[model samples]
Target chain A: MKPNNPLKKEKIWRVAAVLFWLAAWQGGAMLLNDSLLLVPPARVLQRFFALVREKSFYSAVLFSLARNAGGFALGLAAGVLLAALAARARPVEYLLRPLMVAVKSIPVASFIILALVWLSGRRVSVFIVFLMVAPIVYGNLLAGIKSESVQLREMGEMYRVPWPDRVLYIELPQLKPHLMSALSLSLGLSWKSGVAAEIIGVPRGSMGYALYQAKLYLDTPSLYAWTLTVVLLSVLFERFVLWTVKRAYARLERL
Target chain B: MTRLIDICKAFDGKPVLEHVTLSLAPGVTCLMGVSGRGKTTLLRILTGLETPDSGTVEDRPGRIAVQFQEDRLVESLTVGRNLQLALGRAYDAGKAESCLASLGLPGCLQLTVSTLSGGMKRRVSLARALLYPAPLLVLDEPFQGLDADTRGAAIAAVRRGAEGRAALVVTHEAKDCELLGGRLITL
Candidate 1:
C-alpha cells in the first residue's frame, strides 16, 4: 500500500547488485567445494550473529573502539591547535612542513611496523591511528586557515571585535567545513589503519587479534564477520562525530 | 581635530599621492577625483589604515568608524551581529533596533548577511559605522548601491547621527556633498 521511494529503489538496486556478486561468490565456492578457500555469505552472516554473543568478541571490539577513537580525538585536538599555531608563526609552519609531508607520504604499513617498535603492543593501534589522522587533520585545518578571506579579517580588525569575538564570529565559521571534513576522513582512515596495525602486531584482546586468530584457524566466516563489524562501526562513528560537529556549528550560528 | 601634512605615497616607486597635504574638520566632506586619482588613498591615509611615506598626521583620536568600499559584513552572521561587532557591547539593543529600523533592515535582523542583497549589505555596513562610538567617521562611497529616496534618507541619517564629530564622506557625486551640507575636498 506504501508508495515506492525513488531513493529507496536506488538503494534496493544497489543491494540487489551486492546480492548478485554474493551469489557469484557462493557459486564459485560451490565449484571449489573447498572450506579453506571461501565461505558462503549466509554462513558468514550466521557466524557473525553467533560471534556477537561471545563476551571476548565484545571485549575485542571495545578495545579497538577505545584505542582508535581515543587516537582520533587526540589527533583532532592536536591538529587544530598545531595548525592554528603554525598558521600564525612562519617558523612553526616551516618546521612542520617536512614532518607533515613525511607523514602523508610514508606508507601506513611502514608506520605500523615502525610504531610497533616505538610504542607498546597495546598502544600500536592508537599510535597508528594518530599517525594516520594527524597529517590529514593538519592539512585540512591549514587549508581552512589559509583560505580565510583577507577582507573579512580587515573588517574584524576595523570593527575592533575582541579576540574572542573574532575567533568565534570569523575563524570558527571559516574552519567548520574543514573541521568536519577532517573528522570524517580521519575517522575512516584511523579505523582502517588502526585495525591493520593490530592485525600485524596481534595485540591481545584487540579486534586485530581476533582477526588473526580467525585467519590462523581458517575461520573465514569469523574473519568476514569482524571485517563487516569494523566497517559498520567505522561508518557509525563517523556519522556520530559529524552529527556532534553539526550540532556545535548550529550552536555557534545561534550565538 | 585631524591634520595631514605633505602626505606622499608610492607603490613600486610610482607615486600615487604627490605631496598631498589635507586637513579634516567636523561633518561630511565629499571627496571628488577622477578615476586613478588618489581619493581613496587620501581617505586610507587619514584613517591610519595605510601610512603615507612623507606625512606627519596629528591630533587623531582612538576610535574611527569606517564604511569601506566593499560592505565588509560577516557573511555567516545576521545583519544585527555585523553592526554589533562594530558597535561593541556598550551598544544597547534598543538603539541598534531603531538604527536598523531607520535603515529599513529592522525585520531582517535575524537573517544572515549571506542572504542579504548588495544594497542591504551596504545599508548594514553604513548602519554599523553610524552606531559605532567613534571620534571620526570615514565613508568610502557608502551610497554605492541605494535607491534615490534611500540614498537621501541615508545621507540625512549619517548627518544627523554624526553630531558634530569629524565626518569624512567620500563620493564622486558633488550633489552628494551638497546633500550632506558640507565642504568639498577634491583630489
Candidate 2:
C-alpha cells in the first residue's frame, strides 16, 4: 500500500465534499423536474461543453477578458501612484480622502448605470471594473506603506541607498504581501462588477451579453454555464497574476 | 571632524539628551550609558536621523553606515540582497561572501534572513554596516544577542573594518571598548 500522506488525504476529502455537493444539486434538480427553474450540474456541464464548441464563445470570452484585464491594470497603476503620492504629501492624502471614500461607498450597480450614461455600452464594463478595483488597491497599499518600518527607512537613509535601489530592495519587499492581497481582492471584484456592467449595458461580443440572452430565453443551463465560465476565468486570471508576482519576488530574492 | 554642539532633544516633554556636546574623528568611539541615558539619541542626532531642538551639527558627512538596534533587514530577501541595499553600486559578490565569512557566517549569502537565528541576523546587520562605503559607521547595540564567542568575533570584525573611518558604537560593556581599542564616552 502507498504511504499515507496528509496532503493526499486532504485532497481526497476536498474531492469528496465537491462530489457530495454535486449529488445534492442533482437530487434537488430531479425533484424539481423543471430545467427552467434549476438545471442539473451534468446538464450545465453539457451546455458548457457545447458553448465551448461555438466560435462566438471565444470572441465573447476574449472581449470580456480584455476589458477586465485592462481595467485591472489601470486601477493597479492609479492606486499605486496615488498611494505613493499620499504617503509622501499630507495634503495629497487629505485631498484624496473624500474621493476614495466616495468610490468605496458607492454601489457597483449605481456606478454601472452612471457609467453607461458617460461611456459606450462596450466601454461601461471597463469603467466599472476600474471604479471597483482602484479604491481597494489604494487603501491596502497605503496601509502597507504606512506600516513599513521606520527603522528600515532610516537604515536606507543612513546608507544613502539610491531611490531606485531603495524601492527595488527595501520598499518592494515590504510591500509584497499588501500588493498580493490587493491584487487578490480587486481581481474578483473587477470580474464581478465588469460582468454586471456588461449585463446592464448589453454590450455586443461579450460574456455578459450571452448571460443576458440566456436569462431572456429562460435557458437556465446556459446561464449556469456562462456563470461558471466567468468564475473559471476570474480564478484562472487571479492564479496567473499571483503566480507571476511570486516568481518575480523569488527571482529578486535570489539576487 | 564632525561635531555636535550643545545638542538638546526631548520627546513628549521628557528630555532624552540635554545640552550635550561631542565630536567624532577617524577612530573608534564606544558610547556607554545606563538604560534611559540617551546613548541611542546621541547616535541618532549625529547620524541626522533626529534633529536636536537647540544645537548645530558641524561637518557631518552625507553618508554614514548604520546597524540599528533591531536587525531591520528585509526578512524575505537573502543575506546578499540585504547587504546590497546598503552597498548599492559598491556591492561585490566575492567581497560580500568574504565579509560574511569574517563575521563568522560563512557561505550564508543565499540564505534568507527570516530563516537565520537572532544572533545570525544581528551579525548580518553588522556586516551590512561594515561593508557599506561611508565616512562614518554608527552601530546601535550591534552585539545584542550573541554568545561570548560570537561577540568576540563580531568585535574583532568591527575593529578590522573601522580602520581609516570613524565609528561610534553603543554598548553597556567596558570590555567591548577595551577590545575595540576605542575611547569611551559615558553619558
Give a tens-digit lDDT track for model 1, residues B1-187.
8988988999899899998877778866678888768778787788777889997779877788888888878888887777777778767778877887787777777888999899988998898889888888888998888999789878888888777798888888899889888889788
Candidate 2 pairs with clashing backbones: none
Off by over 4 Å in 2: A1-4
**CAPRI category for model 2:** high
| Tens digit of per-residue lDDT, candidate 1, span A148-232 | 9887887777778898989988888988889888888898899999999999999999999999999999888888889989998
Model 1 segments more than 4 A misplaced: A1-35
Point to the candidate with the largest lDDT: 2
Per-residue accuracy of model 2 over A1-255 as CA lDDT, tens digit each: 763998998998999999999999999999999999989999999999999999999999999999999999988889999999999998999999999999999888998888888899999988888888888899999999999989888878877789987888889889999999999999989999999999999998999999999999998999999999999999999999999999998887777
Q: Which ten residues in a row have the lowest lDDT in candidate 1 chain B?
A: B82-91
Write the residue-wise lDDT of candidate 2 on B1-187 in tens digits.
Answer: 8888999999999999999888888889999999999988888889888888999899998888888888989888889888877887899989988888987999999899999999999999999999888888889988998999899999999998899999999998999999999999999
Candidate 1: which pairs clash?
Answer: none
Q: How accurate is chain B of model 2, given as a TM-score from 0 to 1?
A: 0.98
